[model samples]
Target chain A: MDTAILIDIVKSGLVLGALYALMATGLSLVWTTLGIFNFAHGAFIALGAYLAWQFSSADAWGLPMVPAILLSCAVMFAIGALLHFLLVKPFERRQDIVLISVITTLAGAVILENGLQLIWGARSKQIPPLAEGAVEFGALSLRNSELILMGLVLAILLCVGLFLRYSRPGRSMRAVAQNQDAAALLGLNVPLYFSMVFGIAALTAGLAGVFVGTIRFMSPSMGSEPLMKALIVVIFGGVARFSSPIYAALIIGQIEAFSVYFVGLYWAPAVLFFTMIVVLLIKPEGLFGKYQRTL
Target chain B: MSDLILDVRGLSGGYDTTQIFSDISLQIAEGESIGIFGPNGHGKTTFLKTLSGLIDPWSGDIFFCGQRMNREGERGSRKMRNFNYGAVTRRRIDPKAVARAGLIHVQQGNLLFPELTVDETLSIASTAARGRKGWTLAEVRELFPRLGERGSHKIRFLSGGERQMVSMAAGLMAAPKLLILDEPTLGLSPKVRQELCDAILSVRRLGLPVVLIDQDVAFLEQIIDTLYLFDHGRFSGRMGKEEMPDHQTLMDMLFGEAH
Candidate 1:
């Protein structure tokens, strides 16, 4: 009931929502562009976390946090592209593509989780905070890490928005998302765009993974929790509408954060899930979208 | 050895084992204007789609600019669909590859990306322009001044005729050696259709080859040098622009015979 406590919850909610927004944006982009649900997205986040942990750990190279996150992101980008060409591409044109992709990506998620376990073991890992200390005023204190996290999320989302709007490949990706056949007719390389989008989506997820890992513990199962939250964010925001996921993430993040203040930690996921279902029942297109079936 | 820009030999294709058309063969000279007309569901669109690499022929070859795009070294040795064998098949070329080779199909029903602004739509094609020497985005804007006026507006808000203009402009921006217009005049007002037809006539005057599919034989007659009469997925008859039959007589041949 304390004002400072409420502000802290709101602050934490914003940070959590930022990570969710980053992860959800990629999921939404991949879904809209490639018409695949990409269940393996969580695995990319997990992979990023493990990579970041490995890079930043003193036992290993122990590189700085920024470089470590960047390295993990690059690797995840390649993984996303490879997954598209190897796994997603062949099934895309089939009538049952959605079902097939879900199954394949779920299997991919299993592979990634187990692979991380094999490499890093089942124990949790965490990176030291990039920035220490907090900014406080009027009984409300915000950690410097929270500021960085918020800045990173906003900056990445803004860059992505500009890319999709002004850049050639970005415009082409939008065209493909609108209509693949039309895009191909324009001599735009659909496969290349698909690969790029998948790579970018993975990169975002990877970045989110590192951000989450730096702030919290990195477990093999850490991605699944955020992945579920991202899915809820995307569904509640709207599939394919880029900005919708971020708005949805913020709202859900606040809900999950403040629900702890009111109801406790266990009730957050249930509350978010129920909210998404109710929104879908009423609008079916989420908070921002024209009714569309991306997959 | 021939002046043909596109040569199709016994082309047959449709959605997964269902043959929409069979043994369809056609040829087009460079800078020629060809029109195909048929009642709905008779595979006029399929023919255009087949040539543009949107669909693979069940059994046949497609030669663009004298290059066999649909078949490889051992002709007829490979099965396109592999019905008898257990292996899946690859299309001879992808749609984008075909477009790069200068076979651009501006599809019917105003299939522009609804979210893309006119300028963005034009830029996507112009940026990806093959070396086929057609209109650039700037030139396209000049050519379709209406599009230039609504340059930054999303295409979904455009009128039916305006959307058609945007579609044609996009195809032109891609710099196609052969432009395929699939039902370009579908669902347009008479005046708008005339305006579109006039623009298409000007395009033909620019000496670019065009293959058009539309039921409005009168409108097609403006730009088409030759016309193919399609019935039940086969070319039943053919005539030049000068020899085009009267509206009632052509209708009888196209629809009355089916009845």
Candidate 2:
């Protein structure tokens, strides 16, 4: 490909990768810390997109985009905590927690989709872009909204990293994730930590939804694609390796963006999936995960 | 000297429908150190777990610091199978609650949060011990200087001995009235084991009641003030430090004389 085309593909890839990283990080946290796959995570994203859409609507609450995003995140956080208390925490000690989480979260996904459909209707809704114009450099054009989204993703990631690294509750979360019984003995409130984790995961997913919704459009079923993308990124990055998601997202985004230029749009997702399968088969730990010890 | 910190009576429990141990009773007084000895699968760990509220006793009464313990029911079980079905029973006395109640339990295997720094781990414990006038982080660090040196290091990188020290620090931070340790020296070198024993004795000197369980009779014989030998999930015998059996007799009971 030409240099200009290559740069364009690279730019697109980086943008997509930022969004994917944001989306996948939550899935990784839920999987690694709580051992919950959280299929309903995508549903939270969908809920967020719809909330953002509603915020921008003249007939609705008509809030500013930033506040709207924050409000949506808060709502999803509460919802996530509730889901944990009602569904996740109850099944925490079950050997079948994986299966139960999948089924329960799937049920949540269905409920969210149908509920959105019933409330918002099945029509596709578009969010007002954060910025309207594009920056042209030679043959490559970059949208201002994309840049803003990328910055937002990076900021969110950094904030989460700092919180987990420094905050008392965050440290407790890591402890509980490592060993629940041990965490308890250390005086960490295991259930409260679990709730906090769920809330954080939901908040991240919600933020991703708003970002995606502003750049593109939202439908009740829009979650499926991003859900698949997040899952792929998490798997590629290794569920236990939090930083891996960002790197994996970059790789996947670059491959998809570059391939779309030559092989067409449909082939991009195909290539991403193919890469994921190869990684899973060759290095089951993903690109960054270590071999987990199971008792 | 007769103030009982932990009083477990008629405590019986097992996983699922099976009864692993039955009619178990034990008492720990303030500042007293008790060692639990038993063969594997005889419910020694189970009994400790029951007292810590990790596992429920089938039928029993547990009184901690003179208050009754809300026992675990079928619904509150932490069983993996039951959890998968979304049936987690709320802990009546969760680990935090137990710690807040001035009782601390440290189980075998390094239970440090791999991602947290030693300081952070100790901080959480300190916060939990807020109500109780327990040892401060500085005091705990003084007790384990290695912990003070590695205070900022993540748990995953620590040696087994260091991790145990961190766990001990976390427990001690709470300034518990009763401290329960299950197999603290499970996989440590002899030197580390001795250090751990020293640490346990130090906590005891601080006037904390201690309950210790170890497969090694010799190890307990060094630091324990009292001893309870468990056989098939019941306390087969109890003895004071002065009345304890000779090393040979204890070893014969623990592992049996070869042939």
Q: Using TM-score as the measure, which candidate wins?
A: 1
Model 2 Cα lDDT, one tens digit per residue, A5-73 = 678789988988998898898888888788778898888889888987787676688988778888888
Q: Which 10 successive residues of model 1 chain B have the least lDDT summed?
A: B80-89
Candidate 2 Cα deviation (angstroms), residue B60:
0.8
**In CAPRI terms, where does candidate 1 land?**
medium
- lDDT of all predictions, in order shown? 0.84, 0.80
Taking the tens digit of each residue's C-alpha lDDT, what string does model 2 give over B1-259? Answer: 2388788778887766678888888888766789987777888887777777777556777788887775544334445544333364445445566667877887777656776788888887886676678788888878888998898898889999899888888888877777888888888999988888888777776667678888777768776889998888788889998888876787687667981
Every candidate's chain B TM-score: 0.89, 0.87
Each model's TM-score, in the order given?
A: 0.94, 0.92
DockQ of 2: 0.53
Q: What residue pairs clash in candidate 2, if any at all?
A: A93-B80, A94-B80, A94-B83, A94-B84, A95-B80, B12-B58, B76-B89
Model 1's i-RMS, to one decimal, reads 3.2
> Quick one: best lDDT, which candidate?
1
For model 2 chain B, where is the 10-residue window of minimal lDDT? Answer: B74-83
